[model samples]
Target chain A: MNALLNKEMRLSASILSYLFIGFGLMTLLPGYPILCGVFFVTLGLFQSFQSAREANDIVFSALLPVAKHDVVKGKYQFSMLIELSAFLLMALITLLRMTVLADSSVYLQNALMNANPFFLGVALLIFGLFNAVFIGGFFKTAYNFGKPFVSYIIVCFLTICAAEALHHVPGLQALNAFGFDHFALQMLLLLGGALLYAALTWLSYKKACENFEKIDL
Target chain B: MSIVELKDVCKTYPAFRLHDVSFSLESGKITGFIGRNGAGKTTTIKSMLNLIHTDGGEISYFGMPLSGHETEIKQRIGYSTGTVSWYPRKTIRQIVDVTRTFYRSWDEDAYRKYMTLFGLDESKKPMELSEGMKVKFNLLLALSHRAEVLILDEPTSGLDPFSRDELLGLFQTLREHGVTILFSTHITSDLERCADNIIYISQGEIRAECSKADFLKNYGNPGETLEEIFLRLEREAKS
Candidate 1:
């Protein structure tokens, strides 16, 4: 398991620079936290899909003395680790911009409060669906490179757009108003997102492992 | 007793099929797997290690089913493919660092010895190595873990004579130390020099499996080589 993780870390290390650049750009997207949400969604899912493009890494991992299940599990866990790191970074940046930067004129403080946990929850949901589809697709053919990345981008764009639009829905307006005003409800919403993320990640890992077993390597 | 066994192993694809292939590698012996190109040698090797999932068959190593005991079985077996399937950008040191973590009993001193013997520079990336050097690096990774069985696929396909001779010599040393090896190659002469057991596979089936002396006695004139016998057998199969 340690070997698999180390192998993935080395293989995906090159992509880290892209993730950092994307994260920086997203943070600077003035007043729009949805860009940050999209950034995390894309990076979390791109890590595995990009690694799958390198035949060397898959073949090398297959040759290792680990179970197929462990291979899938390690990759899924690594993706989540990256996603969690991005989430923390975004949270820190938002907290600073809201409190320290004290940019009262910027619209981000208002949007962040109104959306509460919806952005993060939707980000988690988007990545969950991405893994379930992308890993299954990769293991099926074992070598198509571009379609998965394109599919993921489309999914994230559509989901983020929908979540952003929800801020204007009349019926959901009361819910958002309640969420923004009540600290406990906001924490509850975050907890719900965390639970959903945990469940979907586990389900994706299971499906990937099952799909991987049937592959001929 | 056989160290590796394959019984009725089969795998199929759109372009090719491995049909009911069966063979066994004896403990403490060098088994040469011979065939022409596209003759299912790599497929058979992959099936044995479960690198490719067999559609129908059974494989066992050291008396246990390979499917259930893959991890434990693979720990004692070292493998190399025809092409070096490794990260091109990683230096030799980085490759070793990742691979060594998988095996609990990895011998660092033995690994370093092979590194020194092969004159492999730690700073050099895989893309910098010659074909022969890549093969040597694979062998070093295979041998460093104290593996009991070695399965190599076309390990000497295109090498200069000196490197081939050195690799063959290393196989002999490993054999003397009681390590069983099964390596596939089209180079019949390499087998004639070192292999005591011969398994000839052609077109996804086991054409022949026997000891070298028995094969020579049955199929060859006193001075004729295994290559001559192999070509003759292949011709007969086609007809």
Candidate 2:
């Protein structure tokens, strides 16, 4: 598992993603999660090219002592690790800015500290769901050039639009003392996001793997 | 006994197809799968790995059907694609590190030795290296893991003359060490130098199969190259 991720993939991607994040930091555009969302999406697209065009995968790994499932699974794990790492880095940055870097505005500090869990949870949820759709859909598209464009559009919708919009759903009427069902909403999104991601991840992986078996090598 | 076997492996698609392809690679013998561009060499290798599915046929590696024992079969087989590359941003060290995790029999000594022998910088990113170096690194990764069978596609392509000779010599040494290799190349000299048996494939099927000795004997001229034979066959097929 470590062998595959040890791939220099991180540097180019990290550079690209952090470049965006740095821009986000400068502009305060919720850079951490969505930027990571972009990162995973880019990684998936890149890997799809690696597997499809160069057939780097066709030659390098097709005969290595690894299972088809493990190969897909390895990519999945690596993407998750990247997402988690990105999220924590952002959280720390947010924390540092609030406590030390920025002037300690009492009102701002209280709001940030109170909303910390909600923001962190939301970012993680966003990253997970986006990674799932992009990674899953990209490979599925790579294996065939047919109508996967529809899927591509759908994945984009899920990642940027539908998935992100869940936070704004009308269920906020169920309130708690601290911050208006913040924990409940996050848990709902996270758990539901996880299950949906799991299913989509597997389907995409299985589709690719089974599709693999039917082709030449 | 046959070291590898393909029986009735057929898959059809809108733009391409591999018909009931059947062939065998013998234990302790080197085999060359000769093919023109798009002649199903890559397909066969991919199907054998179960990297792609076969519509109808069974593949066996080391006498066991490749159906359920895919990983184990792959463990014994050291394969390289006719066309292959590394992730663009990866260093040789990173590629090796990633490959090391999968093979239980990975030999660090072999890996390090090949790295030094190939004059490959461990830290150089794949994107920065030339095509030849990338090929060398790919071969190094596949070879460093000790396995009984080597499935190589166009293994010598993009190599400098010196590196190509040295690598061919390395193949001979591995053969002496009891590795059975399958290779494909337009470079007849490399195949003529190293292969023990040859399987000529053209147009998604096996065109000819024979030992290196028989090839030499039947061609009836010491100077005639495998390239000549391949071109002759390809032209004949075209006609």
Candidate 3:
């Protein structure tokens, strides 16, 4: 497993993937939709997948002394590694916005989604959805990725819109609390999102292994 | 002893089907697997390795079922395709670094020996090597792992005569050291030079499996080469 993951990092990874991890800093943008950072991170991973496919990385890995399922596992591990790295950065930036910049007028008066636990939860949810939809879909044929990515984009944009609009609903404005306001509810949402991300990624891994096993090559 | 065995292996596709193909490779023998284009040679090799899921079959390596013992079996076997187009940007050293970790039996000395023997530069990437050098690099990796069985598909396809002869000589040397080889190729001359056994496939079915001498005696006319015999068999099949 370690060998396979090393293969992914050294042979299959694209430079864009590392560069895009910095996109998590976009959370500090006061008036912009912070969740777009998650989208860009996933997009960077998508580039890795594209380059891997073109290089016949699947065939190369399958030739190794590992089981076919291990190949899928390695890919999932690499994807999650990238996602988690970006997530950590986003989490740190969110922490800064919640404490250090909480009283700043720019963030206080901002109409966009604020950097809080709720936003972090949504970011996790988006990462989970990308795994479930994009990664799982790519393994179905292990060749065609366009349709799956398109489907994920549609679902992701819709989720982002809903997240941006959720706080505006009557009596639900507390979901978007700034400066750790409604801290318990925000923490609960964060916990729920973490759990959902784990569940979705696990399911995606299972589904990818099943689909890849059926392929002839 | 049979080091590799496939019993009634079956795989179906929209346009082609491998119909109950079966064969076994004897230990310490050079067996040439010959078939024309679209004749299921690659399919058979892939099925044996479980690179492709067969619809129905029993495949075993060293008497253990492949399904339950894939990694163990694969550890003892080395497989290489005809081309070397994967990981074109990574240096051979980088690829070898990743590949060597998978095998507990990896021998650095043997790797160094073969790298020198094959004239492969560790700093060079796959794209930097010629077709023959790429194939040799593939062979170096296989031999580095100290595999008991080597299954190669068209390893000599694109090489010049001198390179092909060198590769055939390497096969002879490996065989002398008790390596079991299943070599698939279109070049009958290479097999004629080194192969002890022959397994012929046509239209996804095994047409013959016997010693090279017996195959030649039964199928060839006086003074006929293996290539002539193969062409004759192909012609007979078409008619």
Candidate 4:
């Protein structure tokens, strides 16, 4: 399994994926839809998938001395690794925003989503959605990725819009709280998001294995 | 002893189907899997390797069912297709580094020997090699793993006559080392050069399976070449 993951990084991974991890720093941006950073991270993963397909990575892995399901597992592991790395970076930025940077006028006056636990939670949900929609859809055929990726893009943007809109709703203003103002509730959302990410990713990996098994190639 | 066996194997698509395909490969011999394009050669090979799921049938390697033993079975078997475009940007050293980790039986000495014999540059990527060199590279990886059985699909396709002959000679060398080989190709001359057995498929069905001499004696007249016999069989199938 470790070998397969290494193959994914060295052989199948596009350089853009590593570069795109930097997008997580966007959480520091004021008045911007910070969740776009999550979308870009996933987009970077999508490029890796596209390049891998072009290079016949699946066929190569299939020929290896591993089970078909292991191939799916390797891919999911690689995706999760990238997603979590970006998430951790974003988490660090959010911590900074909630502490030392809390009183910065640029952030305090920002009308968009704030860099807080709630935002990180929403980002986790977006990551889950990508695992479910894009990775799951990709294994159905294992070759055609354009539709799955486009679908993920649409779903992610819609998620971003919803996350941005949730704070404006009456009584839900704490969902966007900054500087530990609603610390307890924000932590709960973060925990829920983590659970959802794990569930969605596991389910996606299972479905991808089943779908890939049915494919002739 | 039979190194690989398939019984009543079947796979279906909307446009084509592999109908109860069955054959057994003799240990330590070259078996040419002859079939025209779209005649299910690749499908049959893929099914044997469990790369594609079979609809109904049993495939066994070394007398054990392939179902629960895929990893073990594949560990001893090496598979390569005609085109070697995979990981076009990764150097040969990088690919080998990853591949060697999968097999517990991997032989570094053997790998170094083949790499040197094939004159493969460790720094060169797949796209940098010529078609013949690409095939040799694939063979190098297989041999490095100490694979007991090598299943190759159209490995000679698109090669110049000299390169094709060179590959045929390598196949013979491997066979002499007691390595079981299943070489799939539409090229009859390749079979004539190295194959001791022949398993012919036409229209997704096993048309004939016998020793090379027996196949020729049964299917060919005094002057009929294997290609001529194949064309005749294909024509007969259509009619």
TM-score of chain B only, all predictions? 0.96, 0.93, 0.98, 0.96
Best by DockQ: 3
Chain A TM-score per model, please list them.
0.79, 0.55, 0.98, 0.98
Docking class of 4: medium
> Across residues B166-229, which tens digit of lDDT does each residue of candidate 1 receive?
8899899999999999978888999988999999888899988999998888877788899999
CA RMSD of each candidate after superposition: 2.6, 5.5, 1.0, 1.4
Structure candidate 3, residue pairs in collision = none
Provide i-RMS per model in Å.
1.8, 3.6, 1.0, 0.9
TM-score of structure candidate 2: 0.75
lDDT tens string, model 3, A1-217? 5898888998899989889999999999988998999999999999999999977899888888988888899889999999999999999999999999999999999888999998999999999999999999999988899999999999999999999999999998998898879999999999999999999999999999999998977
**Alpha-carbon lDDT of model 4:** 0.90
**Which parts of model 4 have CA positions greater than 4 angstroms off?**
none
True contacts kept of each: 0.57, 0.67, 0.75, 0.80
The digit string of per-residue lDDT tens for model 1 on A93-200 reads: 544554555444554345532334444556566656566656545656556646765776677677666766676777665334322345565567567767777777
CA RMSD (A), model 3: 1.0
User: What's the C-alpha lDDT at position A58 in model 2?
Assistant: 39
Error of 1 at A200 (Å): 2.2
Q: What's the distance in Å from true for residue B60, model 1?
A: 0.6
Task: Look at candidate 4 and tell me the lDDT of residue B178.
Answer: 96
Candidate 4 lDDT, B100-123, residue by residue in tens: 889999998988887887788999
Q: Candidate 1's error at A61, in angstroms?
A: 0.8
Global lDDT of model 3: 0.92
Q: Model 3, residue B179: displacement in angstroms?
A: 0.7
lDDT of candidate 3 at residue B235, scale 0 to 100: 98
- Report the lDDT tens digits of candidate 2 across residue range A114-198: 2233444445555544444555554553344333434444554454454334444576322111333355664564466456545
- Candidate 2: the clashing residue pairs are A3-B98, A212-B52, A213-B52, A213-B53, A214-B53, A215-B53, A216-B47, A217-B46, A217-B47
